[model samples]
Target: MALPIPTTLDEITADWLTSALRQSEVISEKTTVLARTVEVLGVGEGFAAELARMHLSYKNGSGPATVIAKIPTSVEDNRNGSELLGVYERELRIYERILGEIEVSTPRLYYGDIEVNPDAASQLERIRKMERLPIWLLRLILWFLIRFNKGKTFPSVLIMEDLSPAEAGDQVQGCDLDRAGEALEAVALLHAATWGDRCPQERYWLVSSAVAPRLFHAGALGARRGFLKNFGRLLSDHTRELYESTRTDNIERTIRLHREVPQCMLHGDFRLDNMFFARDGGFRALIDWQLSSFGPAVSDIAYFICGSIDPGVSEAEIDALLARYHRALESAGVSDYPLEDLHAHYTEQLLLLLARMASVDLLDLGDQDGRGADLVSVWIERLDARMARASSGR
Candidate 1:
């Protein structure tokens, strides 16, 4: 059995650092970290965990001076909900099991692990044992207190190289023209690397939203309703109607269309916030693998384009971007997939993409400024284009 996920910095001791360092091959078995100080980094967009920069002055001088640590957030609801969904472990497994196999650039992972919770229901049991009172009253009080806890026993943590020293792209302002192209190529290369590879999809960690049939319609409908409630004020009447028309069970539609060709792993979320760029206009890495799984690879492209490129970038220009992506995929050894097919997949995934941008909780996105407005405006613009194509019956 593995230890439960560490929820606080206190649990990540110097001994744990030395062990993890040895495992990551950062230092030899003879080296040891005599002391370490953890500095919590400022929270970034959609931060589901604590981001810390560790200052490690090693006695043997064989380890890094700085590294980033990822642990579950102190916010109980966020922690518990993400825990229930196994997103934390999903990321850890990617670093542990997938990164080494792929050609895509990501920050070097140092140490990561997840374990089952032992005292899982101890909190609830303890609350029940609280002093005698009316059962209903006691229950309600306990609920409020327990709500601050992750509720379940899933504990997980990850530590990797600090990308803070590198350039972190902003999701709100989005990436620039050159940056967007580099980002797209990075995506294409990654998809090509795992194209038609069945092992990843077969992994127990893979969670394909499109294949999760049990919750498709209910989730889609909820997503539709959520979009309307959260973003209606930000949309135009015609654009809103255009979005409403295509809000059908997107997940089901995606699965149907995606199966037409070989499916590969997708960056379920490929927005700018998860991107890091080199000063020379290349994608340094794609981070946040919590949503990495199998799907129509074009979903990653569409998601990136929607929020990345400037709103002024035309559909034709985006078509060129797709062409660039297709060529990159080919150069990466993925052959015979036509640019036409990529375009079609990109167009088809637009509806689900629309429903998603419209319905997902606005706050969860952490994009509420000028860039967010542009993202919605541009997304609806694409929706309008989709309507025109449908009207022409093309």
Candidate 2:
């Protein structure tokens, strides 16, 4: 039987480590974990999950000396929110079915699992029972339950080969041109490998390729309201006008319009914080696959640039980096996608990004020592500058 999934750091024990390692075939059956020290990692850098470094001593001096263990957030609201979006299942599915098949750089997964909440299962049944009722009634009940947040939680556990000593990039600090180039290269490799593939199309449940209008519309409205309250002073007239134009329907339309372009698997949440850089100034790996999806690959490009590029980066520099990304894609054998098309799509991606600004409000930033808010503040400044330049035809 599979080991019980741990919800908190305290539940990660030596016995559990031994069973999990053996189950994943990472260690021999004879190997036993004698002791382990857990160090919580990325304390406030992540919102959906919690991570820790497990330093282990084996009875036979075999198996990995250290590994990274990931678990669902202990916060009830975040846990339930994650479950509602199926992000836990999506991450596990990507690790199991997609990552190995692609050329992208990501941490090596040792073992991954998500335990369905029995209470959630029961609640699901209750929702199912109402299916026989009128369609309107069902919709009303679901909307009400979702609005108030019902009892839903999916506890997940993922253990992976630790890639420490590699530093995580700072979103608030942004990145230099060299790091930006490396990030684009990594994204190109991913998009090129999955370009126009049927993996996501066939395994629909494994990827969130399609946009959910209801969920997005609701979130966007709230996000927009909160963003205006917190960062309205930072917006220039042009940017504020631009932000005001990204109504819920317009945002959806912008995203949906890109459907005509080639699609690929995207690290839906591509940003500096999600990437690790080697000490020698090389990209190590990308983490946080909860938002993995298939979409116009350039969307990831725009997301990365908007969040990571230094706010003062010149337009020419940004263009050069994008050109480099295009060349990398071509080098990987992607054809028929031209530089002009990439640029055009990138502009649209920026507008969609403006709509996405509100999303910052959804994050739990209470424990982030204001770093999260500061990150968003800087990110908007970058977006505002970029959008202004775009408007002036620069």
Candidate 3:
């Protein structure tokens, strides 16, 4: 039987959230209601039906205030087991520890929750019937149900300071050199601050011992069979050959590189989607530190460059950005690390990207039939072209 389609914010009301919040003890009945709204933001094309931001309003004794709430996407929760909540909780802890210690920007956290709301019973019932729903959709419905299920659960809500997107808005399409530079700068600061000797022992160890192993395991398992099977079904014969030629060898290379390379704290998912810019271009804030781990610095750097930059960005611009990144790292006192080593690490990072694109449903170029195929084809073409040039001693 087909499951019910996931419910939208349009299908839900502020009252639903308010009741959930009150019931979960995130808010009290005595708190004055100011305004309630659910803005569905950043619903990326993936099985992870994670909503990026949720805004809530109520009156304190002095005046009205707003808080941004985050709920885990169902796909992520299911894939990792019930420990997803623990991950978010740990993320908050790490964010708090590094807030003042690091140069990287992050929002001020208020509170977080891991409980279900008593009012979502009806919504949960509808969710149970849905079939063929995307993973993201399933997560969306599950979030509602989790919030509505009757029981006292700890930390069922988190309050955070609201950071609005830049007035100019997201520059996902155009190749803005200045913005690109700013993004790289932000990443550099993050990498520098999180490197060895600079970071706390606990933080560093978490990356090296826990996060890195989990990511490598997940990536390896998913790529070994799951990703190739799906990706092969999605590509044409010629495209498949290009992808296979560009992919399998690179995966082996990356595995070897992972064994040989020194590890550092890496933002596992460093992409444009996770970045927020200030209106005046004064600063850029990196969010979603849940996937952070100890790995090669090149991994984060490559992800940002490949995933953030527009398709039209020239090779010259890419080189310039690469130079800037190295300079930033050196200035941050990463003197012992050679530029050549960084470059090699970057190649390994690119291989990781190939593995990721093959293994996951995260990229959002467009619909699966044409746009997605075109985007994947373009990626494969770029990979093959770059590999050919390198082999030819370019």
RMSD of each: 7.7, 4.0, 10.0
Candidate 2 runs further than 4 Å off? 117-147, 202-204, 248-252
Error of 1 at 282 (Å): 1.6
Q: Candidate 1 residues 1-394, lDDT tens each?
A: 2334566888887888888888777988889988889887645455467777888877765777788888877665556545544577678888888878988889888888777454433433342344334434543543343345435555567878876556888866666677788888898878888887642754446655454432333334444555676556656565566566665556456667667856788888788878888766568998888877777788788777766666566667777888888889999988868888887777666655666664344224344553445555555554454433333333
Predicted candidate 2 versus true structure: per-residue lDDT over 269-370, tens digit per residue: 899999999998899999888988878887899888988887788889989999999999999989979998888888877877787677676666655356
TM-score of 3: 0.66
Clashing pairs in 2: none
- Name the Cα RMSD for model 3: 10.0
Residue range 1-394, candidate 3, lDDT tens digits: 1112223334224555455545545567766445656665554322223443554556652222455555544443232322322344445556666655777777666544343333333432332345345444554544444334443322323445567754322324423767767777777777777666664554321434232322333333344354566455544454345445553465355556656665566666665556677877755576666666665677777766665565556666766787778888889777767877777676655555655565443223345564344445544444433333233232
TM-scores vs. true structure, each candidate: 0.80, 0.89, 0.66
Quote the positional error of residue 8 for candidate 1 in Å.
1.5
The model with the greater TM-score, 1 or 2, is 2
- Give the C-alpha lDDT of model 1: 0.67
* lDDT agreement with native, every candidate: 0.67, 0.77, 0.52
